[model samples]
Target: MSKLQEVFKNKSGNVLNVYCTAGYPHLESTLQIIDTLQKNGADIIELGMPYSDPLADGPVIQQSSLVALENGMTIATLFSQLKNLPSSTGDKEAAIILMGYMNPVLQYGFEKFCKDAAEVGVSGLILPDLPEYEYETEYGAIIKKCGLDFIFLVTPETSEERVRRLDLLSSGFLYAVSSSSTTGNEKDFNAVEKYLERLKSLNLKNPILVGFGIKDKETFNTACKYANGAIIGTAYIKALEGAANVEQATKKFLAGILK
Candidate 1:
């Protein structure tokens, strides 16, 4: 089984997937961040590839991406760093999923991107702008050939038919956007609860992980109520914003959520 599949197999719920921008805070910080998150409490590391234009991200993530790009973070640099990185933290292996826009990846060459990602122990990908049709016809085959999962996102506005279609296309897990907005925005748990209820009732093939606005213990608990887990990005970034020690900040931030 894939590392992501193993995570679900071992833990039926409360899977904590954390997102971190590559090269954020400093150019040499990517690997350190990955190690810190995995060693602390994150079950999955959704590493964001800095892009000039990231429409799906919020201001916090956007700013991080800008800093990462300014720090000279690139797909090649990230691959080089991940090459020496271990996949497992002792017995449990944390799944690594790259989150980014399609433009930068296409520039890096789609085939080469998948090949390098697989070689570097990447478990999956999340490219929000990749259309379903293009994926099924072109990119999806490349990803599958490299033995990597591709996750799809669905929002509250998505029709049941569309949600099921996305769920069918997704692997590892389906990322359910808590609301129909960009990342880091506030969420209405009442509406989110009802929406998650609908998703639960659909019985999707892959497990569900709610993203966007899941910032702390209370929100994480609420998100995990009906889904397998939740994804936290902005909050974690905020924790690391001005911290003197990234690892310590990561440990404390994760402890607050999973505590």
Candidate 2:
């Protein structure tokens, strides 16, 4: 089984998947952040490949992406850095998943991207802009061939039928977007709970991880009550801003959520 699959099979709840912008804070800080996160409490790490037009990200993450780009972080550089993740991190506990826009991934060549990702010990991918029809027709086979899992996102507005369809296509956990808007926005927990409950009733094939507005312990715990876990992105990035120590910042951020 993939590392991500093992995580779910062994632990059924309170799964904390933290998202970080690769090459953010500094170009060479990718491995540092990943290592620190897993060592602290993160079960899965979603390393974002910074892109110019990150349609789904909020201002904080967008600014991080801008800085990362300015610092000269590309997919090639990210792969090279990830190549040393094992030796740098000490112990590889958390499953690493790449999150990025399709534009950059396509520019890097999709097949090569998947192969290199697998070679560097990446477990899965989260391409929000990749449509379901395109995946089934063109990219699904390539992803499966590389032994990489693909995660699909579903919002409260998604119909039950479509949600189940995505769950069937997805290999890892299904990302349940708390709202139909961009990341880092506030959400209505009452409405979010009803949505999560609705998703739970569907009996999806994959685990559900609620993202967007999941910034603290309360939100994390609240999300876990209905889904398998929660994904923290914007809050964590905001924490890293202007911080002197990335490792210490990551540890403190994760502790506040998982401890």
Candidate 3:
């Protein structure tokens, strides 16, 4: 099993996943932010690849992505940044997952990108635009060869058959988008609950990590009640912007979720 799978399995329920844009605020800040989140009890880290066009993202993430790109963040640069991560210490070993779209991977060459990501300790890749069929046909074998877990997202609109297919092929946990729209958009809890019920009815083998619009303790608790874990993105970034230090911001964010 991949490190991501192991981590989620160990944590079981109420896992806190954090997302950040690579090279945002500053290039060197990428590792620092991730390290901070880890120290503050983020179970899994979703490091945004900083693509030029993040279609599935809301304004907050889109703005962060643009800033990261302006700071010269690219696939190669992100790998380079990962290579410079600090040595592991204490009980703070967090799995890193690269989240982005497909164009950047194609631009970087799929095989080379996978190889580089593995070399730099990324546990997996989350491609929002990668259809299950296309991945199975083209890059699935290559991704497996590199020992990288490729995650797929399931939305309310996802069919029962598609959910099963995605679950069977998924190595890491499946990302469950809370709503049909982009990340960070708010929707009814009833809708989210219904979606969870639908996913449960499918009896998927892989664990699920809920994402989008999960900003505080209430939402996190809601997600934990059904899914294996919950991911917070825009809220964490908002915290990052408010605090003087990344560590301080991470602590505040984590405290809110854990409370």
lDDT of the candidates, in the order given: 0.92, 0.93, 0.86
**Where in model 1 is the C-alpha error above 4 Å?**
87-91
The C-alpha TM-scores of every prediction are 0.98, 0.97, 0.96
Provide the global lDDT of candidate 3 against the true structure.
0.86
- What's the lDDT for residue 1 in model 1? 73
Ranking by lDDT: 2, 1, 3
Best first by TM-score, ranked: 1, 2, 3
Q: Give candidate 2 regions above 4 Å deviation.
A: 87-92
Report lDDT (Cα) of residue 196, candidate 3.
86
Clashes of each: 0, 0, 0
lDDT of 1 by residue, 36-137 (tens): 888777999999999999999999999999999999999999999999796555745578999999999999999999999999999899999999999999
Error of 3 at 83 (Å): 1.0
Winner on lDDT (2 vs 3): 2
Query: Lowest summed lDDT over 10 consecutive residues: which window, candidate 1?
Result: 86-95
